[model samples]
Target: MPPCASPLLLRRRLSTRPPHREHPKLAALLDVLNPPPPSSTPLPHALSSAFPSPSDAFPLRTLPRLLPRLPSPLLSLRFLLWRLTASTPQPSPHALSSLATSLPDLSSSVPLLLSSSPQPLPLQHYALLLNLSTHAGLFPASLAVLRHMRSFGLVPDAACFHHALRAAGSAADVSAVLEIMSGSGASPTVPVIVTAVHKLASAGNFESARRLIDKMPEFGCVPNAVVYTAMLDGMYNFGNLDGAVRLIEEMEGSGLGANCAPNVVTYTCLVKCLFGKGRVAEALGVLDRMAGRGVMPNRVFVQTLLEGVCMEQRVADTYNVVERVVGDRGMSSEQCYNVLLICLWRVGMTAEAEGLAQRMMKKGVQLSPLAGSSMVRELCVRKRSLDAYHWLGMMEENGVLCDSNVYGTLLLGLCEEGHLHEASALGRKVVEREIHIEASCAERLVELLKQYGDEELASHLLGLKQRPGGLSF
Candidate 1:
C-alpha cells in the first residue's frame, strides 16, 4: 500500500511484535504432537477374575464364596465347571455343599446372558448341574435344579434324568422321578431307569427294581437297551439265577441283540455269580451261549474269568485262558498278558512269571505295577540289571510307574550288587525328578555314592533327606 510495502520491511515488522506468553495455536499443535502417557497402574478387573487364575482352581474347597460373587453368567458357569472337574476325585463336603447351594443362583444367571446372545443355553448345562448336586448327596438341591430347568421349559436329556434319579429318595424324590416319567416334555430315559435299578439292587431291593421296569410303559416310558441289562445285573446281584436267565431270554426275544443286547457286562456279571457259587461249568457255558449270540467276550470279561480261575489256584486253567485270549483275534493280547503276568506272580510261579515277563517285554506290553515292583525287585536280586532296567524303561515308556518303591529297590539292589554306573545314573535321575527315596535307603545311598567317589550325587541324596516328598523309611 505504501509503495507496496517492501518485503524486507514487512518481515522485520512482523518479527518485532510483542511476544505472547502463550501461543494458543502453537501450544495446541505441540500438545497434539506429544500427548501425555497414560498412568502406569493397571485398571480394575471384576472380582470374578479370580476363577481359574490360581486361587480357585486346585483344592477346589476354596470356591464357595466366589460361586455367587461372580458378576457375569458365563464366569459363574465356568467357575462351577472348574470346581467340579478338578483332579480331586470328590471335592470336600464343604465345597460340595457350597457348590450345590450356589448352583441355583448360578444357573439363574445363565439365561440372561444367553437370551441376548445368538447361542441358546443348553439342557446339558442344567443336567451337568444336576449331576454335580446328585453326586454330592444334595438331593434337595438336585431336585431344585431339576424343577428350575423345568420351570424354564428346559427338558433334561437321558443323562440328566439319570443324575436326577440318582439323587431321588424319600417319598417326594420318588414322586419327582414319577413326575419326570409322566411328564410330556421328557420321559424317563433308559439311563434314568438303569440308575434306579442299580440303586435298588445296591440296597438289596431287587423286587422294587423289577417292578419299576414293569411299570415303565404305564408311565409312558419305553424300555431301552439298558433296561433288561440293568434287570439282569440286579437279578444276578441278588443270586436269582432263574430271574436273570429269564431276563436274558426276554432280551434275546425282544431283538435287543440289534446292538448285542445283554452286552459283555450282562454275561460277565452272570459268570462272576456262577463262579461265586462254584458253578464254573455253568459260567463257561454262559460264555459259550453269549458268544453264540454274537456278544463276544471283552478284555474285562476274559480277565475276570481268569481272576476267578487264579483265585481258585487253577494254574493250568489260568494259563489256558490266557493262551486262548492271546491266540484269539477277538481279544486284546496286551490286557490278557498283563493280567497273566500279575497272576503268575501272585501264584508264586516265579520262573513262569519271568518267562512271561520277557515275552511281554518283547511284545511291548507293560506289566502293571501290581506285580511290576515285585518283578523289578526279583530281577535285580537275580543280578539281571539289564533286564530290570529294560522292564523299567518299558514302564517309563508306558507312563505306568507301577511302583514308587521301584527306584529304592533298584538303588539298594544295584549298589549291593556293585552296579556303580547304574546306581550313579539312576540316582541322578531320581534327584532331578525329585522322587523321594526311603529315609534309610537314602542315607545308605549317600554313603555308598560318596564311598564310590560320587560326592556330588551323595550330596544330592543327602539333601533329599530334608525335603518332604523324599522317601520315608
Candidate 2:
C-alpha cells in the first residue's frame, strides 16, 4: 500500500498522474468505500483496514472526479462530510467550487452540506449556498442558511444580506432587521437596511417600517433620502396617500442635512400618486413645487406629466404645462410641442391641433414623424384626402419624413375620392422611394383601380406586388 501523505503531497502526487486517472491509493479507497457488488465487509472496517493512518487524507481536487464513480449519492455525501469534518486545513475556494458544481441538485445538496460542516465552511461557501438557495426559490432554506451563518459567527457580505432580505418577502421580521444593525459579525449598512425597510413598507407594515427608521439613528445609521423615498414609493403603491404625503413632508422638513431632502424622484412619486387618485390640480402643484426647489425634472417625470395631463383632457392646462416645461428647459420645445399636438388630436380638438402645427412650423420647430402621421390621419378621417396629399407635400418640403402609413392612407383616400390621376402620380412616387405600403392598403388601392377600368394604372401598381422590396402586399 502507498504510504500516507499530507494533503499538499497528495495533490502533487495526483497531479503527476495521467488526466482523469486517480492515484493508486485513491482508487483503492474508492474500492473500499464502494466494494464490488455485495462482497464488502462493513464500510468503516474496510476503510480503516485499507487506510490505517488518521492523516491519510485524500486530495480535494480528485473528489469531483471520485463522486461519479461512487454507486450512490448518499455515499458521495458521506465522503464529503468526512472530508469537511476532518482535522485537515480548510478546502481551497477552487476545490469547493468544483465540489459544488459536481452536485446534481443544489437544493438537495444545501441541507446535507450544512449538516456536514460542524466546523463552519468558509464565508464564501456559505454565501454561495445562500445565493443558490435564493435562486432556487427556496426562501425558507435561504433564511435557514443565513441563520446558520450568523450562528457560526460569520459576517456575511452585503450581497448575501441583500439576497436574504429579497427572498424573505414580507415574512422577514423586525428582529432580523435589528440584528443586522446591532448583532455581532455584522455592521449596519444603509443599502441593506434600506432593502429591509422597502420590503417591510411594501408589505403594508408601515408601523414596523416607521419603527425601523426611527431606530436607525440608535444603530449609527441615519436614514437618508433613498430610504425615505423607498418608504414613500411603498406608501404611494398601496394608496396610503395621506401617509405618503406626511412622510414626504418629514423628509423635506428634517434637519438631516442635504442628503435627506426630497429629490426629483421623491416629488415625481407624489405627482404620480396624486394623478392616479384624480387629483390633477394637486399633481400640477407638486410639479411647480419641485421646480421651485431647483430640482430639474427627468425624462420619466416629463413623460408622466404629459401622460397624466393628456389623459385628463386638460387641454389648456397641457399648453400651460408645455410652456412651463419648455421655459424650465426640462424638455425641448419641439419635443413638448409634438406630445401636445398628439394629445390635441387624441382629444378630438382637430382645429386646435392644426393651428398648433402651423404655429410650430412657422417657428421652425421640426415636427416628429408621429406628429406628422397624426395630422395626416385627422385630415383623411374628415374626408379631406386632397388636403392630406397637399399636407404631405408640405411635410416633404419642410424635410419632415412621413412614414409609410401616411402614404398608404393618402393612396386609399385619393382612390376613394375618384382622383385616379392624382393617385397614379402618388403611387409612382411611392414606388420610386421604395416605400412599402401595408398589405390591406395596397389590395384596396388595386381593387379601386380595377373597378375604375384604369387597366394601365392598375397594371403599373400590380407590378409592385412581384418586387420583394416594392410593396409588402
Q: State the local distance difference test value for candidate 1.
A: 0.63
Encode model 2's per-residue lDDT on 1-473: one tens digit a residue: 23334434544564566435343466565556645577747554566677665244555555676664444444555555545434556555555556655644555556766775677766655665665455555566566677777777877777787766755656355356346535655665777778777777877888877787777787678878888888888787667888888888877775656788998888888888888899898988876788778888876677677768877877788888888888998889888888878767776778778889889989899998988998888888888888888878888899888777788889889999977777888988977876666656667888998898877766656555422123233
Which digits, one per residue and each the tens of the lDDT, describe model 1 over residues 1-473?
A: 11233434533443465323222122222222223566342211221233334332323433443443333334455545534444435554455556666543433444443443343335555655666657556576666666666656667667766776777664357556657646736666566777887666645566777788777776677766577677667667667777777767767775544543677887787777778788776766765686577777787788678777766777788777766656655576777777777666665667778888877777777666766887787777677776787678777776667566678778777787788877877888788876767667778878788788989988877766632223222
Candidate 2 wrongly placed segments (more than 4 Å): 1-138, 171-182, 254-258, 334-473
Q: Specify the poorest-scoring 10-residue window by lDDT in model 1.
A: 41-50
In the predicted model 2, the residue pairs found to clash are none
- Candidate maximizing TM-score: 1
lDDT (Cα atoms) of all candidates against the true structure: 0.63, 0.71
TM-score of each: 0.55, 0.51
